[model samples]
Target chain A: MRLRIIKAYFLKEMIELIRTKMIMMPYLMPLLIVILFGYGIKMQVTGVRTLILDNDNSQISRKMILKFEHSKYFTTTVKNMSEKDALREIKKANIDAIIIIPSSFEKNSLKGIKTEIGVFIDASFPSRSTTISNYIQGVVMDLANDFNINSSGMININTRNLFNQALRDEEMIVPGLIGMVLLISPAILTALIIAKEKEEGTIFNFYSSPVSKGEFLVAKLSAIFFLVSIAIFVIFLVASYLFDLPFRGSFFLFWLASEFYVFTALGFGLLVSIIASSQIVAIIVTLMLTIIPAFMYSGMIMPISSMSGDAFITAHIYPVMYYNHIIYDTFLIGQGFNSPTNISYLLLLFGYGIVLFLLGLLFLKKEIK
Target chain B: MKIFITILLKELISFFRSFGLVILVIYFFTAEVYVAANGMEIEAKNVAVGVVDKSAGGMSKKILSNLHSPEFQTPKFYKSQKELSDAIYNKNIMVGMIFDEQFEKDYYKKLNPTINILIDSTTASQSLMAIGYIQNILMKFNNLELPVALKMHKLFNQNADTGLFMGVSELLSVITLLTTILTAIAFVKEKESGTWDIMLLMPVNPKIIILAKSLSQIIIIMIGVVLSVGLILFQSLDVPINGNLLHFFILTFFYVATTAGIGLFIAAVSKNIMQISQLSIVIMMPIIFLSGAWTPIYAMHPLLQYLSALSPLSYYIEGCESIFFRGTSFVDLLPYFGGVLILGVILYWYGFRKIGKLF
Candidate 1:
């Protein structure tokens, strides 16, 4: 844990990571990030296939029809048809829902009486259908308000959601992939660098030659981190220019954040690599720790908040959670990045990176012994 | 039988010695339990519901009241359409509603009255239920007098039980797959560790070693299986395990044998654990992804669906649902048994051949 020991270890770890293909990942990440973010979002909110059965064919009903068909929410298979026909269409999945305007609608309106428009929604995908329902209701009521249905009551709200726009699947996955790719690449490199030495009986060279662990690790991580940063920069440039994803924040901040993230991942990966006698244990242990957590709890398909207390608590223990928070926050949030927490997370990431880097160095001594 | 038993015992003894193997099991099962209980879910409880009432009339009050009712308590007091839209786009709210100014007039008039609901469809599902609940209340309030019937149609059945749906499929996949893969690796990793030859050097025949390993793990596996079942049950997941408990053991035994065959096959062929582990992952990922554990396999494209059908998990789940959810007899589950046994035999035969080549 001495300063020299730490620095020497950092150098060694970095050299090991660099010698392995871990150094190439940072550059590869942005391309992977873009592909993962740009292409993965299946946001098909259209072609919702709506059929309208206009019973009234009246002015008000026609207005309702106009609102639905033109508002971009409904791709119409609408017909002035029988209830039986509508039912058949519904069964065929030809329409998400049917809007029924009764025969008495216009008549009732003329008499200053109650008239109703019916809407059926397919709420199987509660997320999408609910939004669709609300959108339908809003368009109808806007026109109705113009018609002076002064008593329309708080109008029925319907909304339909097509696809997610807040964050794409690629965006969610790319950041996690950053952690995942680095996990294997750097850790394997770090382990093999050391393990290779051990396996071939070269540790005596390092010990006998006065090549301190601290210097070795620092040089190793720094080289890998620098190479990774270059990789990330290229990916970001391509992602922004080619993929049309908005790079809303400072490139420097992303670098700072990922550097911290990479360091921590690389550190733990290195530490586990050192604990291992062979390259095999190192790879399995690192992957087992990194891959599953990266996939499951990173707010991709499942929300971390929804995870039960224990799993939720456990998810935080992995560096993946922090990395995910930062990646999403920086990439998607687009909010000004001058906050104390953001700054702190960045620092904590770096701090852990350094600490774990040291831990790997310290642990390497024991493994070697 | 004795040879198989010998192989199994040798594998089990090797497993306890491998720190990585034991830890992986603990991590996998424990995490699965935690994920089933907490991580794997659809959450919408605190989702903001934005409402805009242009009417400012009597019905607005009623709609607001209804939204605020104790039985249907949801926060529904959003101000403007812009605000609501912004909230939704920003992922702040799950749903939004806009009642036109004439809402009061339409309800007061005996005319076709309508209300617009602008809903944030993200972070929520089966939203028509919420919309329908409101419409039903209004319909009841009006004594079913509205000319249009508020029919609620569900798009996809998100209402399908997550625990039952996920647990039953996953139980089959992870348990069968993990056990088989581990059993396969058991003897081989020890051989790599140089422990197998040491055991072979002792009084024990290779056959007895297999038996001891299989028998040794029987208790631990049963314990692991029970613990997993307990973890799931503890969360009140409420997935039915209606088949005979004894039948579970019987099915598991055959399934395990088949998986063990697969494991042995992997171990016998591979020079090292990494090779087999990588192979296991490659084999397992598609099976897990396609077998409808996390996402519906039927939901996948046709090609992927066919691939899913190829996985043993499809049979396992089909048989499991029959036994667990539908409560069918073991005879009814013969297809699953047959599939497992066939797969096992093929893998074991290949494994034995590979082992013969290596030794």
Candidate 2:
């Protein structure tokens, strides 16, 4: 009898889901976010606009200037500007850094006297400034080494990047984005689905009828779970194919981990719906609980271990934090099913899903209290 | 005027009374500031590394010791390549290195023995920085006698506190998003509750209603901005607001006006709260991404870099940075401020038309 009721409820919910564009949103939203973030977020700082005010038109000075111009890291614009104009440009943020070559540059180099190349960087954005300084140092160092000045005890280091060989920021971000995409729509969709019944007074239909609360709850979970799974699958394929993200681990393991994550997110949404009286309230609560914490506390941008005190504890409790670790480990580092770190976090997420689901069932009432 | 006053007062009361929205607003502002202040660091510091030193030569020892400190940790010594790779797999270390046995012998013989390094580049930016640091150490060891020097001056932020800059930008982004979402939801909620139709049927001008609703939202959002900027940013974080406070506030008002206008337009088109929420996310994602808050605007592709100008959040971020970090006066920020004002007028004009037709 309960099975029949559950089946009836599921069919009704599915029909409603199909009719409304709301049902299609979970899939579309992730696709949109993936494309947007894929194109947008870049960590490698390039094309630093540099102005070189060379007073020394000497061949040596011109060579150094050419190196900066030739390099992909900098967009060098050679200007014969005064110190005042250079300072004004830096203040105005028209130029990121200024390379001033003094008239004595070539003379000092020829006489074996030490010459200082003045580099003034706009430090308003500290990260960019630091990168600019590093790039400048590299350029200058290459020039110094080209001089073939003999030095003692020269040891060369071969830096080889493991896993992400190219050190592509996109590789790291794409995996993290899978977690972000899943967290964004599913939780809110589930919360709104349940809260809509309550707000529109449709939930009372089950109270007046013989249909069990368990049937209703199961029906709702299955409907959302079904919709969100398709979205996750599409996102996974897009991320792997389009972004060239290597799926080093087993596909089944990745799918299993995603299912566990989706369940936990849905459980969180169900809990929010039970507490929230309106759709607006449910959305705000779900978003505040999910998006903010997922983005901030999860080891997406900042690694969980790097975070101290409350943030570490906060990361520990959130299910996304566990999945974030699992996804990154499995995808990038190629951790297998038996991998201890991957196994433990994935298990923790499963446990989180069960607990939240049980709590959601407990809070979901037959009558609007 | 009386109708505007009554509508504004009613909206204000309802806003304060919505405990859920209030808590969310408080949480978003406080958590954003707290996370921004604490966790955001660009420089890779204290990364754990595994070192396999077969040579144990003097040069290798000097290089290993130099690796220990702010950029990297005291690297755990390993016996073989397998153990180092295992450590990386377990994430016990972010990087692994194996020094060739003839490292010192080759150095003396001018046969440059390579110190083979394995870096887990999942944290790409930090790993890149770590490579730079390692290269720097090697270069210094190479050029012990050669005095090729370059003078570097970090102009504005002498200490180069990246967290401070991130915190300020994050605070502004949150304020813009929160205000826009809240204002739009406020209008959409009334429509969903059927109160909007009654107000339209009553003897009230649509213009007065629009003016009142926007005014209330702006005022409430300003309060949040003041709290976040004054108390959290200025005092708690000790982030410098180098420009004129009065000018900053005025510029902020114009920017808020632009966002509020966008919100009203979204609300006017949306039939229910659900649609409002969906539309808001769709609209907000690109704006937030392109706003130069998380990623630098200059880093984006040139076309996107140009298109980012359309997002009011972009202008605000630029204007805020100029005022806070560069200590640029009001005159210097005229372009950004003017952009906000122009955008604000156009959006509000369209919004007023759409909402008036609905009435």
Best by lDDT: 2
Report the Cα lDDT for candidate 2: 0.81
Relative to the true structure, candidate 2 has a C-alpha RMSD (angstroms) of 2.3
Per-residue CA lDDT of model 2 for B14-128, tens digit only, reads 9999887777777767776877776777777777778898885677788788987667778789988988888777666877888878886888788767789998788788778
Model 1 alpha-carbon miss at residue A123, Å = 16
Residue-wise lDDT of candidate 1 within B180-296, one digit each (tens)?
566656666667768766766766555455545544555456667777667664345655565666666666666566556566667766666546655675556555555544433
> Over 4 Å off in model 1, which ranges?
A1-154, A158-209, A222-259, A271-297, A304-322, A325-355, A358-369, B1-14, B17-27, B48-161, B164-170, B195-223, B230-238, B329-332
List DockQ, one per candidate, in order. 0.16, 0.60
Error of 1 at B205 (Å): 9.3
How high is the CA lDDT of each candidate model? 0.58, 0.81
lDDT of 2 at A218: 88
